[model samples]
Target: MRVPVELDPDVDDEAPTGDTITVYDKRHYVTYLRLLDAKAEGADWKEVAQTVLHRDPVADEFRTRRCWQSHLQRAQWLSREGYRKILEQAVANKL
Candidate 1:
């Protein structure tokens, strides 16, 4: 999937939690993928926060870690469950 160029660099301290995907999830689709990839590769959270989430770990450790953890959790959820919703939407659109 293409990384969305228009995605906002700023991330919320905590990602939204729900059974259904939100507009925030759609907007940060690429961010979620990147976070997943980083996790799989054993990338450090500090580096991931700085590079992927655009947060300064040194400047705000607590907030940065919170954002990373929340986003990573959301990313995993997207991989495990949210993709099904996306597929359903795609199929619905094609019908």
Candidate 2:
């Protein structure tokens, strides 16, 4: 597993999209984990946006929602497919 980096409360309006991981993914790994944990606990998107992404849902609902959704989707992608890439890299490093 990757060591946790400093948390960045700042988030983009939209997350990086694509099959492969990107630098944004590496930077926002903690954000992705928080998003996933909140989701599993059935937290509201608005709450997640405000708490995890540090966006004001009421002040900018559209942007906040967009950012939350994109990040959540990316988080799910990481759990499902992106984790394999991380594990592969870890194993390769050990070799």
Q: Which candidate number has the best lDDT?
A: 2
TM-score, model 1 to reference:
0.86
lDDT of 2: 0.88
lDDT of 1 by residue, 1-95 (tens): 32343454678888989888677787788889899999999999999999989999999999899999999999999999989998887688789
Question: What digit string (tens of lDDT, one per residue) describes model 2 on residues 12-54?
Answer: 8899988777777888999999999999999999988999999
Q: Any residue pairs clashing in model 2, and if so which?
A: none
Report, for every candidate in turn, its global Cα lDDT versus the true structure: 0.87, 0.88
> Once superposed on the true structure, which residue ranges of model 2 sit more than 4 Å away at CA?
1-4
User: Which regions in candidate 1 have their CA more than 4 angstroms from the true location?
Assistant: 1-8
Backbone Cα, N, C clashes tallied per candidate: 0, 0
Residue 16 lDDT, candidate 1, scale 0-100: 86
> Positional deviation of 32 in candidate 1, in angstroms?
0.6
Task: Provide the lowest-lDDT 10-residue window in model 1.
Answer: 1-10
How much is 73 displaced in model 1, in angstroms?
0.2
